[model samples]
Target: MSATRICALSELEQDTALRVEVEGVPMAVVLDGNGEVHAIGDTCTHGEVSLAEGFVDGDTLECWAHGSAFSLTTGHPLNLPAYEPVPVYVVTIEGDDVLVDPAVTRPTN
Candidate 1:
């Protein structure tokens, strides 16, 4: 539940997605277009699909199955078929390591 070390910060490339599990929580860690790290629920809200396997365009990750675009910071679905928002975790970088806290997430709206 606390901030757990997920991986090395160098392991993530800019604008790429990395699937990680912390405290049994499946998450997708992304280095966005601006080279900022973000953590969000890996599963798509609309279907049984992995968001890590989806497309990363800027800060939006589109579910490959239903094309549901979820905001990286807010985790809100930007389009249809997925009215619910995914969970966005808190990512902290310590030196060269990436830490994520699954217990902490952005407020859903």
Candidate 2:
């Protein structure tokens, strides 16, 4: 499947995460302080909680339930409690639109 328009780019605040669901898939969209957009699974692997409701530090999203931080770029958990990494979706930007493809994922390195 192709990328679907999630929201307008202007609607996102820097250093924060926005929860969006596309095709029944839950995702956390983040616009970092560096003006970069990222899409990852909204569910935290450690606590089964919403990562979008957590904290955004630089390129990492911290889980509010257990304090586990996941990389917004690779979706890898950088600390304990969350050994499993979330899925990182491909994000596309067109003018003022922010798009995400639930079927497409970035390879974690």
* Clashes per candidate, residues 3 or more apart or on different chains: 0, 0
Q: Tell me the TM-score of model 2.
A: 0.98
Worst 10 residues of 1 by lDDT: 100-109
Expressed as tens digits, the lDDT of each residue in 1-109 for candidate 2 is 8989999999999998999999999999999999999999999998899999999999999999999999999999999999999999999999999999999999988
> Which residue pairs collide, candidate 1?
none
lDDT of 1: 0.91
Residue pairs that clash (backbone atoms under 3 angstroms), model 2? none
Candidate 2, overall lDDT?
A: 0.96
Model 2 CA lDDT for position 14: 96
1-109, model 1: which lDDT tens digit per residue?
Answer: 5899999989998877889999889999999878799999999988968999998999999998899999998999999899889999989999999999889987866
| TM-scores, each model vs. reference | 0.95, 0.98
What C-alpha lDDT values do all the predictions have? 0.91, 0.96
**Which parts of model 1 have CA positions greater than 4 angstroms off?**
none
Instruction: Give the root-mean-square deviation of each candidate in angstroms.
Output: 0.9, 0.5
